[model samples]
Target: MHNDVEEILFSKEDISRKVKELGEKISKDYNRDDEVVVVGVLKGANVFMADLIREIDIPVYIDFMAVSSYGYSTESSGIVRILKDLDLEIEGKHVLIIEDIIDTGLTLKYLTDNLKSRNIKSLKICTLLDKPKRRKCDLNIDYIGFEIPDKFIVGYGIDYGEKYRNLPYVASLKEETYK
Candidate 1:
């Protein structure tokens, strides 16, 4: 797995520090007495959500949504599908969507729209990484840990064919690995 990486963009320590910082900001922003619903976009966001929620000081209810625009591919198909939906009813609840990375904004936009129609009290987005250059639609991302270059990265919950998610840090994979 290590050899497959062309370069390491962010180390484990770097990610940890950023997660802690994001958690602090989130805790400060939503310091209300009521618990907030922290929705994790499944598979990729699982690792990020776990670390982030631990840093949050306020009470939080966790749930997962498995939405996909990429299936065994690096580029987005521009078609979004929800493989799994939130188990908790988010109506009238403050909801925060946690994402591993936001590249094209298609999946998140679709998801935010879907969640908004549910009549949730409020909705915000937080992502571990963002590639604004590739955005196809405008989105208001409330929290962002890093603005990365246009590169296909894997590790730290991100993956290529489900093989690199176990890596401890984010890295760009060798072209041959994915090609």
Candidate 2:
């Protein structure tokens, strides 16, 4: 799997440090009395959310939503589908959405809109990676670990055709591997 990577974009230590910083900022921004409901966009954000929540000092309730815009393809379809919904009721609660990466921003925009209609008190977004060049919609990301260029990246819970998610660092895959 190492040979398949074109280059390592972020080491595990880099990611760890950034995640800890983001967590601390998040912990300080929200009131300690308010229990934030952290919503992780599954499969991809699973690893990031796990590490991020550990660094947070305030109380939090965790949940996951599996929304798909990309199937086996490297590019998004632009159409979002909710494979799984939250089990917890988020009405009037402070909500935070954790994402592995933000590419076109379509899926997250759709999700944010959907969640806003649920009567949540507030909604904020935190992404481990942001690809602003590929964005098709405007998004206000409250916490960003890194701003990455447009590339097919996989590792640390990000995957290509469900592979490479177990890798501890972020890397760009060799073109031939995905093509």
Candidate 3:
């Protein structure tokens, strides 16, 4: 897995520190009586969400939603599909959407719009990586750990063809590796 990487972007230590920082900020901002629910976008965000929630020293709940916009492709198809919805009803709850990466932002926009209809008290997005250069839709991601370039990134819960997600650091894949 490491050999396929062209260059390491964020080391394991780097990601850990960033997650801790984001968690502390979230803990401080949403430190209230209202229940704070961390909604993680499945598969890609599994590792990030797991590490982030531990840093948060508040009573919060966790839920997973499996969404698909890219299937067997690195680029999004512009259409978002919810494979699995949240089990908990978030109406009037403080909802925080956690994601692994924000590339085109179309899927996240669609998701946020859908969640907004639930009449939640508050809604925000926290993404581990942001590719602003590739953004096609408008999005307000409250917590961003890294603003990365538009590249084929893998590792640290991100993947190429569902591989490399177990790697501890973020890395750019070699062009030949994908081809």
Candidate 4:
């Protein structure tokens, strides 16, 4: 028997269901034989992007972008830099930024602007989790998996000091965990 989870906020089933729903929406929005390129932020977004890409039908390509906002803090450093860029050129291709989470939106805003400057045919944002309270920029997310509270959560590709990404579901970290 499987052990009960300590705090499974968004279960695996929930995640799967949401991804399918978002996929359908995206498919309708981007109707074409050629699939849009889905770019995932590094580390935390790896798992979420893997699952989301499978759910999304059409001939899609995948790539990873590694970025760092803060070296050792939860707060944004207000500067975003790409540690790694797409192996596939994004010019003239429909691009969807698949992200694990959107907190302050600084990183995402920076990324979207950068991609726009590349002259892509289309650009959109798709995030599995949204933390509205922390959003610092005006943005629109084409496909959103879940809208969560401002609480600091770990698991389901989120982490606390680089831990808890392996958890099958999301959970708000214990108050004392960050203390």
lDDT of 2 by residue, 14-62 (tens): 9999999999999999999996899999989999999999999999999
Q: Worst 10-residue stretch by lDDT in candidate 2? A: 1-10
Off by over 4 Å in 2: none
1 or 3, greater by lDDT: 1
The C-alpha TM-scores of every prediction are 0.97, 0.98, 0.98, 0.92
Model 1, residue 21: C-alpha shift (Å): 0.3
Number of backbone-clashing residue pairs for each candidate, in the order shown:
0, 0, 0, 0
Give the better candidate number (1 or 4) by lDDT: 1
Residue 56 accuracy (lDDT) in model 4: 75
Write the residue-wise lDDT of candidate 1 on 56-157 in tens digits.
Answer: 999899999998889898889999989999999888899999999999999999999999999888999999999999999999999999999998899999
Q: Best candidate, lDDT-wise?
A: 2
Candidate 3 Cα outliers beyond 4 Å, as residue runs: none
Task: List RMSD in Å for every model shown.
Answer: 1.0, 0.8, 0.9, 2.4
- Cα error, residue 23 of model 1, in Å, equals 0.4
- Model 1 spans with C-alpha error above 4 angstroms: none
Error of 2 at 52 (Å): 0.3
Q: What is the lDDT of every predicted structure here?
A: 0.94, 0.95, 0.93, 0.82
Clashing pairs in 1: none
Clashes of 1: 0
CA lDDT for candidate 1: 0.94
